[model samples]
Each structure stands twice: as structure tokens, then as C-alpha cells.
Target: MKKLEIACFTIASIKIALENGANRIELCNQMEVGGTTPSHEMVTEAAKYDLLKYAMIRPRGGNFVYSTEEFESMKKSLLDLKEQAIDGFVFGLLTEDFQVDISKNKELIQLAHPLPCTFHRAFDQVIEVKQALEDCITCGFQNILTSGLKQTAIEGKEILQALIQQANNRITIMPGGGIRSSNIEELDRFVQANWYHSAAITDGSNTANAEEIQNLKQKLHA
Candidate 1:
């Protein structure tokens, strides 16, 4: 059966996602910057949930590239959380010219140790998407979250499909960005993904749409 996974950027939302039938979560902070490294407290807190949790490990927001200090911080954070019952870790590192920084990534991956590692949207910034996917695979990443180099997964479906074929089980290509209740069924059928990510929050002009999450799960599992 197809599975559904949601990305939760906060404590409240993490609980919501799990309660709403999310099988797994990608925990992060500063969703405004497309997710920065979550605090240690947040990671430890998420550990209490039964759902599998993967914490975002990016130190900052501007881009996927990392400085020496930033990389050091990432390593330290992962090491500190090593005792947590988290299922995995999500992160990525790239060169200034938009290439995977394999050596730097290897260090962080090593720190993550037994936990599965996911290459975040940093894959979107690589100069060559196919090469970048290959790089992540070679670096021993278990998955890649991407929108096929376009702004949203909806807009990038064609490229995403191609990427899925190219990945060919070497690594998981998870399509995220702008995924939602109304569109999830189409995406699930089209992408054949066992997992998907979305905010599914209720705020702004969204009160009437608050029930959309329940509807989404029904449709996804139908």
C-alpha cells in the first residue's frame, strides 16, 4: 500500500501530523527560510512521539552551501542528539557552484551514524540535477527531497518523473513543495510515491479548509 509522510516544522504541527495518520515526519525550524536546523530540545521532544522522526540539520537558511563553522555545528548537533530515538536525519551540503559537497556531507553522515540520512532540497540547487542525484547516491544518502529544480512539485512533475526513473532505487526521490489535500491524490497516483510532505496547517484564510487534512488521508488511503 502507498504511504503518507508529512513534514512538520514545529512541535504543535508535529503532533498534529502524527495524529492525522502521518507515518513519519521531517522536523525542522524556521519554515520561513525553508527550514533550518531544529533545536536540540525540539528534537528530543519529538522523540516522545511514536511516529518516526527525521530532524532537519541545516545550520542556516540562505542556501545549501555550508561554511566550516556551519558544518562543525551540524556535526555537533547530530552527535548531541545521537541518543535520541529519532528514526533519521535530513540535511544537505553543496559547493558554491551548485555541486554536491561530498566530502563535507560524508562527515555529517558519519556523525549521524546508524540513522538514515536524507539529502534535502540542496539537490534542487545543483547545476546538474541528474549528476546531483548520482552524487547523493554515491555519498550514501538514503533519500533526496526535491521539486525537480522547479519552484514546486506541481510545476515540476515531468522532471520529477524523470528523476524518479533515473534514481531507479539507488535512492528515494521525494517530491515536496506546495503539496496539499486537493492535489495529493493526483500526485500520489502520478508519482507513485509511498510518501509525501506538506504543511497542512490551518491559519490565514484557511479556517474552512482546516478539515482538509482528514479528507486528504481518506483519499490517500482510499
Candidate 2:
């Protein structure tokens, strides 16, 4: 059974996604810039839901690489959210050369301990996929949300399939980026992923579409 994870930016979006049977929410803000950490008020409000809510811990969105100060800021955000009902954390960091910051990511996984931690699409930034996957597993990240180093999941299906084989259940390789309800079934069958991700973006729209989410899940079961 393939599960759906939607990156929701608003309470309304969260409600729609959840009502439509999205298995989880990757909560964030500033989707135009990829995603930045959402406000405390937003997190507080979204945490009221019954579904699993994974807050984006990124302090900013330009790149995965961070300075010492930025790293500290990420930790601070995590600490602040620890007391909230937020279920888990999603974030990523890389070295100047696009290598996973093993030491820092280990710190991130540890800091978010006892809850699931996911290294986001920043996995696409890594030049060394095989080694980076091992690092993510070693660092205790529960999920790696990636597009298989491509701009979109459909474009990267071959690599996604290879990644799934390489992962072998050690860590979940969730195919995100440009996934839509219309194409999910095809990818679901070929990708063989138990987990899928999307923003539920519709034509001429930037906001999430509940109907699309419902349709996507329905297609998954079809």
C-alpha cells in the first residue's frame, strides 16, 4: 500500500490533505522558495490535527549548506518545536561540494531523537548518491525524500527504482517533486514505493487541491 505525504503550507491545506486521506503532512512555508520553516503560530495550529505532522526545520531555503550560525538556528527551531505535538522533523544540509554533512546531520537526527527525522530533497544536491544514502542510514534518518537526483519523480523513475533496490528497506526512499494524482498510479506500479509525496498542485494554481489529493489516493487504490 503506497502512502501519500503532502507538503502543506496552510491550515486549510492541511485540513484538505488530511480529509482526503493523506497519510502524513510535511508542514512548511514559502513554497515558492522551496520551503522555509513555518511560523510558530502555524505549527501550533497545525499540531492540533490527528495526522502525523512533520515540521520543516529549515531556517532558510536557498541551499542545503549552512554556516555555524545557521546550524545553531536550526537546532534552536527543533528545540522550540520539541514540546509541540509535531510528530517529526524534515530538513537537510550539505557540504560546499554537495556532500551530506554527516557529522551535522547526525546531530540533527540525534537532536530530533525519539521522533522520525527525514533528510529532504537536499538529497538531490548530493553528488554521491550511494555514499550519501549510506550516510543518511548511518546517521539514523528514517526517510530520504528525493526525486532521485532529478527535477521530478517521473523524470527520475529509473534512478528511483535503483534507489529502492539499493535502499532495500534500510531507509525509506520517498519519491517527491512534481508528483501528481494523474501520474501517481503509474509511478506507484513502476516505482514500487510504499510511500509517495506531492504538493497536490493543480493547473493554474499554487495552493494545494483537496480534490486532487482525494483523486490521487483513489488512483493509488485503483
Return the TM-score for each candidate structure: 0.92, 0.97
Estimate, for each residue in 81-200, the C-alpha lDDT of model 2 and write its tens digit: 988988999998899999999999999888899999989999998998999999999899999999989999998899899999999999999999899877888888888998998999
TM match of model 1 to true structure: 0.92
Q: Clash number for every model?
A: 0, 0
**Tens digits of lDDT, candidate 1, 91-159:** 999898999999988888888878999998878788888888888988889988888788888887888
Q: What's the true lDDT of residue 7 in model 1?
A: 68
Give candidate 2's TM-score. Answer: 0.97
In the predicted model 2, the residue pairs found to clash are: none
Minimum summed lDDT over a 10-residue window in model 2 is located at 201-210
Regions more than 4 Å wrong, model 2:
none
Judging by TM-score against the true structure, name the best candidate: 2
| Alpha carbon lDDT at 130, candidate 2 | 91
Local distance difference test, candidate 1: 0.78
